[model samples]
Target: MGILSINMDDPMDVDALDAFLKIAEYRSLSAVAKLYGVPKSTLSLRLKQLEGELNTSLFLREGRSLVLTEAGQTLRTHAADILGRCEAARMAVAETLDDASGMLRIGATGEFGTAFYSQMLFAFRRRYPKVQLDLSFFSPHTLYLPERQEMMDAIISWDDGNAGQGGAEQLWTDRFCLYASRDYLARMGTPATPAELEEHQAVMFRQPAGPQLWLLQRDAETLSILPRSDLFANEYWTVKYFAVASEGIAYLPSFFTQIECERGDLVRVLPGWESAQQRVTLRVMRPSALSRRMGAFIDFCRDYFSPGYVFNGPRYYVETIFNPTNTTQTGEQR
Candidate 1:
């Protein structure tokens, strides 16, 4: 409970610090030792030395594994951080080094945001475990320009109003589809085309009635439809839930309904109707002014989502030009 004398005079204890952190993470001395290709005895001795220096017992044995004591858990936190700094310093020695650790603030829409973010975020975390991620989700709105927020390092959005404002990158393109519960289709009958959509009971988005026409392509000709709905809700999740419950037909992104469609829970009506592209883009709001850590994250995304990096249905598109006017970025990074 008393303040302990902290010693900074000691030369950087990188090895011991790394060992302790690893041990704490694995909760096993043998595991840490094996990981570092060192004997368990040496690992145990190094940990003990660290404890002695700090004048505290860092861990307690419980069965075959080690559990951090109250003091130990606190030490583990610091040790991991210290090790991270050491790695960064080592990288700094080389001109090619990039800082890969820091807090990255991101914003996105609810449905599509939740669907892709969970996986994209998970993968990013695994690759850059040291980076702290903060995400905010909202319905599509021209609220805060990603650059103005300053806090938001990047934005993955369908709206490209701020596309070229800062260094921007496009992640993926999203397609909206008319979806309904299987049971509802069996009873209400499936509409063969957009014109037929009027007859089905529908769930609409936000304070609006009737089905919203999703423009598929607008170059040579404009493809649009007016969806009729009895129930209206602001959130995409709400529409999805209602659709799943056999309430009515809801227009939603294919990605969000992909799982359900595959499982036969939801069916895509009016196949071959190309939904106008909803530009799914990522804009680096503060690219040039990015901190070293933020830069690393941007680089990670560029590579992680690159076509060659991983193969999947969702393609990545990179728009060279950043358009601050339009709602979506034209570049595809997929």
Candidate 2:
């Protein structure tokens, strides 16, 4: 037999209901106590207190098992459901404690994520030591997942439909230039004019096959190229890397290669005649409540790409402007 009666004005503790549900499921008070890391007497005392509050006999002893009464059956069903929902709510709230902490996922093309925008790695770390940064490279289609916004926070990519409607904004742009590793030039010689590029081993971006069309602009003059691509990669950074390894000449976005180009590791293939300058706008999206962490990333990039002013951090950059368009170089317009 158990306590029985009801007090309508008094509220039963939710934790007590959870304990009652666990005790009913396990049928052994000791088992529920051990599972909860409490003494068996504590479980009994709490259950007794709960029965007293509800003023009902919840359990009746039948040999080793404690059978549930009509009231117990009702409370057990409701208790499991309510406690399950409470646990879910707890996990949901725990995820938002961005106290400037936890993981912040960012996406970008390999070329852009590595070269210019990576400055945020050092800068952001200096500010938020507890927050972890997960930077993913270009390609395989896994890098950009706009459909799963809960997992991916923001992305620095072309203003494609990836971000959707007002979720994305134009951060800025990175100008492009023609380049080849010094070692490659030492062996194959350099392209004195854009026309000579056809005769050279050229590394190209992610395209299937055949000769590619390269459009170059200098003032009102536009030089269109039908250069032969001897090597191919799915991403721009990979193309630049192939060129750096002395594979061949490559056209690269300016910001990331500035440090390497200045170091003479990768030399300007056509220093006199500027290659086509490509401008791609960086689109970032972090909707709903995680805007603070997303804001930190955006601000960090804004400071790093502040036109001509070199980032005085764990990163490096040279102040070089191609022509016509000039503002703090951030990303690409794509």
Q: Which one is best on TM-score?
A: 1
Residue runs of model 2 more than 4 Å from their true location after superposition = 1-99, 116-118, 137-146, 158-167, 183-189, 208-213, 235-238, 272-290, 308-334
In candidate 2, where is summed lDDT lowest over 10 consecutive residues?
325-334
Superposed model 1: Cα runs more than 4 Å off:
1-99, 138-143, 146-148, 207-212, 217-221, 307-334
Candidates' C-alpha lDDT: 0.66, 0.65
**Candidate 2 residue lDDT tens string, 131-240:** 67777545424445543333356766643335434456555664557788666687788878777887888787754454345557667777877567768775676676
**lDDT digits (tens) for residues 63-182 of candidate 1:** 998888888777766776676566546445532445466566787755555456767877778777877887866545542543225435677766546554555567666678778866
lDDT of 2: 0.65
lDDT of 1: 0.66
Root-mean-square deviation per candidate: 13.6, 15.3
* TM-score of candidate 1 on Cα atoms, chains taken together: 0.58
